[model samples]
Structure formats: structure tokens, C-alpha cells
Target: MGRQRKIQRMAAYRRRRAARVFRGLKRRLGWALLGIFLIFQILAQLFYPSYLTLPLARYNREPYGLKHRDDMVMMEQSKFVSTRLELTGSYGKEQVDLIKLGGRLDESANFNNLSYYPKKWRWVPFSILFWRPDVLTLPITFDDKPLLNYTLNYSKKHSKKATDASISIRDGNISIKDGKKGLSVDANKLRLAIKNKYIDTSGIVRLDVPEASIEPSASSADLLHVRQQAEDIISKHIVVSVAGRQEEFIPSKEQLASWLRVVEESGKVKLDVDSQVFGDFIDAMDKLVAKPAGQTIVSVVDDREVLRQEGVTGERVNRLDFEQKMSSILFRPGVYKYISIDLEPIMPEVKTSYSFSHTQAGLQAKLREIGRRYDTRISLQQLNGEGWGASYRGTESIPSASTYKLYIALRLFDEIKSGRLNWQSSVLGTTVDGCFHQMIVVSTNQCAEEWIRQFGRTALNSFLYERGISQATTFTAEGAIRTSSDDLLRTIIGINDGSLAGGYERDKLLDMMGRQIWRQGIPSGTQGWTANKVGFLWDYVHDTGIVHHPKGVYAISIMTKGANYGIIAKITRELEAQMYP
Candidate 1:
């Protein structure tokens, strides 16, 4: 019994100790839970306190209250407005009305209308506590195609087409039209203005459609001045006459009107006379008043024929002087009643001609006398009927110097006549005719060399041989071709008789020879028209040509060596005196 009582006491003490330990653990766990809840509340207040207005936080504290006040005011005062478009100038006086260009006011806040909201939320921390007003825009909507089509139609209907200033002649009178300004409206600018007024939702809207000015090319006053000047010129009448002519030419008023022309030059308008028509009229008048030149006649005096009468001067109208006078007369209103023209006199160089048949012996003696003074061998020939009539050592060939250029010119013309070449065909740096002119008139060696290079030397020699000029040869000695006096005389005779070339070719060659720049040889001694060629090199000198004399036309060729040009000229003068005296 004693052992059982000891065990019961130990069990009771163990139960009491267990109960005490459980109470201490429960107290510590309750304090830890309270600390965790306090930390969550502080975090919520610092970050997202507005979330505290939910049911959980509301249940913990008093019910969350929101301060409400009807304090928001409408930001845009005047909403309902109208738009007007105006057009000016030649586009016509018109105004277009655009209805409902602005937004309508809504008393109640709606999705489509502009409204204001409070600046802050209900329970947000560190934010405004009361509601503040802010504007929200709601744009008005409308179709733009109708307004665009209406604007374009209005602009087209009232627009004036621009006209350029002009001047014209009708029934011998001048007329002019002045230009006017025009206007055009811009449809794109009007469309943009209408869209802007609706987007802004403003109270009042007024738009002036953009326009541009269209100007004409010419003005009215300028054309009127040109017309007045033209009329004044056509109304005036003048008489023109040539001296010693029975016919009188008075320009008709209609002809005068036809001469007037309106032209624009150098950015300016002008009234001018037609120069070609005036020149034609002057040419016709000149032909009617021209007179043929007189020739000297030989008469027998004391059983000897001698030159008796000197040639009379002929009359011709001066066209250039008459044209100048007419220009002034036409411009003046009452300066002169009529203009009379006087013909100028033309004098002949040779007044008389003598019989060469009777003087042929005397000419031969004179030639021999003049030639004896020079030590060089001299060859001379005078062409007669179909052949040489008189010659002194004329068969001897010598250096021809530049005289070979004449052959080159002949060959060039031959090619032209054969259709292988033309006068205007370019050779080297110049035309064929230009080369011919330089070779004969100016005696340019470069031109001659170029032509000979183009026209082979062998061909030239063949041409000479076929033409029956046997004594002359192609470039043979010292860069100089060889020719005899008789051969040159034959060539001249051939040219004059039209056997060497046609009339046109022969005339062109003769014309170039006549206008030769170096006239110190044969032409210096002649009194009439002389077409000649001269050649010179070192001590060799030669001259050959056809002289148109009062007695008759004849060919002469003189070649000399070791003689100067002065001696050659003296010899030619003596020969001419003997042949004509």
C-alpha cells in the first residue's frame, strides 16, 4: 500500500508541470501575430492606401467616406457656331454658308461631348482632396466632299479667262485690244478652314477663301501706241521719179499699207516697214532709167585713121541713195511734196582704138627694143586668128612659178563640171571657190599646193596635153611648172572662146583673175578691162592675159628671166601703146 501511494503522488506532479508549459507558449504566439498585422497596415498606408477603401479595410475602421461637390464648370463657353466663306475679284461677289461647323453644348457629361473631371481620386494620399475642372474635347463629324464640290463649282462659274494684248491690221487700219486681270479661288484652302473650325469647337467662325491674280501678257496702252504709229505711216503719200525717164512711179496707199508690219523684237513691240518690198520697188525703177554706155569711134583724118570722138558718160539711178531718201520721206508728214533723183555719170577708161593690123610691125619693133635692155631670154606672143600671129622666141619653155595655180584652178573646175566636185565643196580649211580665189587673186602658195595635192600633177599634165597646150608641163623644176608664151596664149584664147570651160566657169575664173590683188604687171599698163595672171619667183617673172581694148580683144603672154617687175611693166606699156596707137 505504501509503494502505490508514492507512484500516485509522482503522476499528479507531472500533470501540473505540463499544463504550466502550455500556457507560456500560447502567450508568446499571440504577441507575434499582433506584430505581423501592424507591419501589413503600415505598408498598405505608405504604398496603396486607396485600396484600403475595400470591404476588409472598411470593416476594420469606420466606413470610408468620399467628399462630393458639384463644382466642375464647362471649359468651352460658346459651342454652337457658323462658318462663312467669301470670294473676291473676278471670281464674282459670292458668300458660301457652312452649317454646324462647331460642336453642340451638352448640359450633362456624355461620351461624345467635352467634359471636365476632378484632379484627384477619393482616397489617394498626398493628393488634392476636392474635385477640379479639366477640359475634354469631342470633335464634330461631317462629309467634306460636298463642301469641296461646291467650292470648285463656284470658282469655275465666276472665273474670267485671261486674254493677251494684241495688235492687228484690217482694211488699211490698225486695231488693238487691251488685256484684263482675272481671279481664281483655291478649293483646298477652304476645305482646311472648315475642318479647323469644327475641330476647335470655337464660338464664331469666319473664313475668306484664298485667291490668286491672273495677269495678261501685254497691256492696253502699249498696243494703242503701236496702232497709232502704223496708221500715220500708211496715210502719207509720196512721189518718186528717176532722172531722164518718161515713166513716173507713185506708190499707192494700199501698197504703203502692205509695207507696214507689226513685230516683237528684244522683248518690245514695234511697227516696222518691210525692207524687201521697198528694195524690189527701187530695183524696178532703176532698170527703167538706165542708159547704155557709149563707145569711142575711129575716123579718117588727112588720109590717116585716128581716134576722133571721146566716149560720152552714161546715166544710171543711184538706188542706195534713193532708198535712204525715201526712208526719211515716208516718216515725215509734210516735209516734201515729191522727190527727184539725178543719175550719176560713169566714165570710160579707154576713149579710142587704132587698127592693130597696120601697127603690128611697129609693135614688134617696140617689143624687140624694150626686150634688148634685159640680159635674160624673153619669150612673147600675140594671139591672132585661131593661132599666134606674132612671136619672138615664144617656143622656149621656162619656169612658170605660181602660174601653175591657174592650171590647178582649171582642173578643180573640171571636177566640178564632171559632178565629182562642187564650187562650195570644202577642201582643206576652205571652200573650193575660196581656194580658187586665194590661188589666183591673192597668189597663196599654201592653197595652190593643197589644190595640186588633191588634183594629181600627172592628171594636170594630161589635161594640158589633151587641150593641145603641149609646151607646158606639170611641176618639174625647182618646184615650178614649165610653160611657153605660145602655150599660155593658146590657153587664154581657149578660155575666151568658151572651149576650155562653159561660160559660167570661164567667167568665174576670169573674174577672179581680174580682181587680182597684185596688179603691178600687165594690168598696171592697160587702160581697159584686163583679166590676167602673173607669176614670179626669185629672178623669173611672167604675165599673161586677155586685154579688152577698143580696137578688139586679144591675148598676150610675156615671160622673162633675170628681170624685175618694173622692167616687165615698162615693156608691157610700150607694147600696148604700139598695138593701140
Candidate 2:
């Protein structure tokens, strides 16, 4: 009896071992099969037979969005994938590809003149199933000029022109225009005929023309829905809450209506904001709603930031996403609630601590490289106190043409602020304020020269040197009228930050700088609000400006010899890419 029990246990152990061996063999086989399949895929990519069909399709990557309904993306996908696509079609016998069809449509590009564009082959097996299912956006371009011309000529000679259904809103009132169907060329049918003839390759080619009744994009029901939507928009009121601020911005209903218009797209009536009006409105609201970013100076030594100052984060409205938010709320019927949007946070251009990613040495290298290419001495410095901006040749003083007029204006304003001079004080037979406008705005030299003579060159140089504007500067044409990018940066920063000029004088200076007529240099480069002073003489051309942005205020001074405004523009653009990137 004991032996029988022992034999049963042995049998069970042997059975378990066999099962383990079988499982090991199965895994090995699976891995081997996978390796073979990968090898085949690689080979197929290099060498595959032409004239083969594969079950594959391309789709848009961004068909899904936050603005879309829950089912809209799926519906869009279904609608997109179900579209019957044909690369080459034939009418009776002659093959019609995109180039052929395009050639037929264009008057200048005759069918005989167009060279056939061959297909770029891709031989991946079952790519749509395993890889790139919902991300491949196939690029397609269609020019309908020839088709429009053909239709115009046909309507003039034989057929009636079809009118599209349209909706319009005037003075908060809605109007709908009904569409009428008319005999039109059947483009799809013609394309199909061309495709059919292309596939056969065994018949006499005869191009055939097809005709069908044209249909309008918007239907009668859709027009009614659009009218209802338009009515809803005019009556709706939106409250924009910015970062939970106390003031909730609410534009008047009339103002909102004036900025809106109704249109049809993709066979459906939709609401679209007038981009021009929106741009103007957003510009006005930028400072009101969007908080500007803050900055901090970091001390860098031995390729690492040792000490850093305090920092603050700022935020601005994401224009595209904000538009989507408005559409999501305003377009839907009975959606009268305020849009809850989380404004995108903007980080300071100067980081809290400088790391290896952006060390002082790296920046100097880039500056030197760009300067070498332009074959001109370049100096760019930040206005942040204590630490200098860009350290490479920042204090190399060159001739200051009209840029020094900024400094002259500053000195004159300083005198007025101290009661030694007044706005009505005379310079070159004009009031000080009036002369300042002419000096800064139009680059006129009379007021600046007269003011310098009145103040005396020694006193002017003493003021600049004492104020820590420049160590050695001459604004008086005594020697060469020299100033550095560092001085310009400090002067602008002082005015804006209330270090140099008092409130009233500061405001006056900044406004004039922004309105400074010659903005072709630094102003043209940076994508922000710029207030710059430009100087141009025989060989010297310089631009120094404070470019204000929601990220952080940037002070730049580009002084060049034998380089035009074009090079200055290019240099500023390159500098922004370095600082902000």
C-alpha cells in the first residue's frame, strides 16, 4: 500500500516537469516567430512589389479637442476613415491622377505640358493597425482655380450658376438666404471615371465629362439653427474671471455682437470671431488681465549659480485656448455660464538659479560667435541692477548719434524735476517739453545741442558718471560723442523702474520713447511692446530699447559700425532666441 502511494506521487512530479518543459518550448517558439516577423518587415521596407494593395489609411492627429463634444471626435474619425479614396481614376479609358486632373483644370498647365509625378512607395505591412493609427495627418493640397474657370465658362454658355445658402446678422438682427440647386459639373463622378479607366489598362482612352445638380453646404434646417445660435449670442453676457481677481471683465452685449459674425464651414453653420477686432480688443485687455512675469538676479561663479534673489511667477491668456473656451460656451445653445479658464503661467526669462544649461560662459560664447559672423562689435546688457546683462564687450563705448538725445532728454527732465528748469524753459526758441518731443520723436539735433550747451559738457558728463550710467562718457561732441550699451540699458531701466525720473517725468520719457519715429532696428525685431532710441550717422548705427513683454521686461542695446538696420534687426532676433528660448 505504501509503494502504491509513492508511485502516484512520482507520477504527479513527472507530469509537472513535462508541463514546465512544454511551456518553455512554447515561449521560445513565440520569440523566434517574432524575430522572423521583424526581419521580414525590415526587408519588405527595402524591397517590396509594386502594384500591391494594403489595408491602410491616414488620419488627422488633432481631430480630438477640448471644445468638441464627447462623440464628435469619434464621429469625425468615422466620417474621415469612411471616405472612399482613389489615387488614380479613369474616365472611360484614360487614367486621371491628381496631376492630370489639376492640369485639366489649369488653363496655363495643359495636359500635354504637365510632367507625370510618380508615386512614393511605402511597403509597411499592416501599418495602420500596429502603428500610427490616430496621428498620421496626410498632407493634401487642392487648387480649384481651373474647376472654377470651367464652371464659370459652362454657366455662361450652357448651365445656371448655383447660389450657396448664407446667414447674416445686422444690428443684432438675423437674416437667412435660401439656396437654389442648379446643373453643375459632377467632379466626383468625373474623378471616378478617370480612376476606372486608369485601372483597366486595356481600352481606348476617351475623356468623359459628367454633370450633376449642385447642393449648398448649409441646409434650410441648418440655417434656422444658425439663426437661433446668432440670437442666443447677442442676448448672452460673459464674465471673464482673471486669476480670481476682484474685477470680473464684462464687455457690453453690443460690443460683443459687433465683434462677432455668423458663417458656414464644413457643411455646418458656425460662429467665428472677427480676428482683427479680437486682436484690437485683446491688445487693450492684455495689461488689464494678464499679469507680467517677474525676474531675479543670480550670481554665477565657476560654472554654477552660487547666490540667487527672490522670484515671482506670472501668467497670460492663451489666445488659441481662450478662443476655444469662448466657442465652447458661446456656440452651444442655452450655455449662459461664465467660462472657467486657467490662464497659462509665464515663467521669468531669467531663471531662479542659473545651471549648466545657461551659464554665463555659454551666453558670452554665443554673443562672441554672432558678433564674429556680423563682423561688428556687439554689446547687449540686461538692466537688472548689480549684475551686468551680457558680459562680452558690454562697456565698449562707440559713437552715439541720436541715442544720446535720450540722455539729453533725461538731464533736461532731471532739471525740471529739481525746479532748476521747467517744462516751459526755453531751448532753441522752443519750450523744454516741445523740444523734448522733437529731440526724441524725430531725431532733431537742435534741442539736444542747445540743451547740452546750456548745461555744459563737463556737468553733463559728471551727471552721467555720478549716476553710474557710464564710467567715462562724452555726450557733448567734445571728442567723439561716445556711450556704451551698458549706459543705454541703465538709463532706460532707471526711467522705467523709477530710479532716475520721478512719476510724471518717467511717464513722459517712456511715452516719447515708444513713440520714437525710427523703430526699424530693435523695435522691428522683438515681438513685444518696444520703446527704443535709434542713432544713425555716416558709419555708426545703433538702437537701444526696452522691450516689454508679459514674460519679463528686456533692455537691449545694439551698436554697430558699417551695419544697417537689417543687421541690427537680425541681432535682436538672435538675442531674444537666446534669452527666452
Best by TM-score: 2
Q: Which candidate is the best by lDDT?
A: 2
Sliding window of 10 residues with minimal summed lDDT for model 1: 67-76
Across 127-201, the per-residue lDDT of candidate 2 in tens digits comes to: 323332232221222334433443345334434455455445555566665766766555555544544443211
Model 1: per-residue Cα lDDT over 1-581, one tens digit each: 88999899988888888778777777777877776665665444344322112222111122322211111112221132232334444434565433322222331232111122222342343233232222333234334545566656766775565555544556656666566676666667756665564333333334555677787645666666666666676666677776666677888666666565445578786656667777777767667776657776655432245656767777777766776777677667773358888777766435433333335464554455455556433344454532224566667777786677667766777899889998899875457776677678766565677767777777778887888877445554443578877778777777877887666889998988888766777777777678988876434678888887665567777788756567667776766666666
lDDT of each: 0.60, 0.60
The TM-score that candidate 2 achieves is: 0.38
Tell me how candidate 1 scores on lDDT. Answer: 0.60
List candidate 1 stretches off by more than 4 Å.
1-359, 375-388
Model 1, residue 192: distance off in Å is: 96
TM-score of 1: 0.37
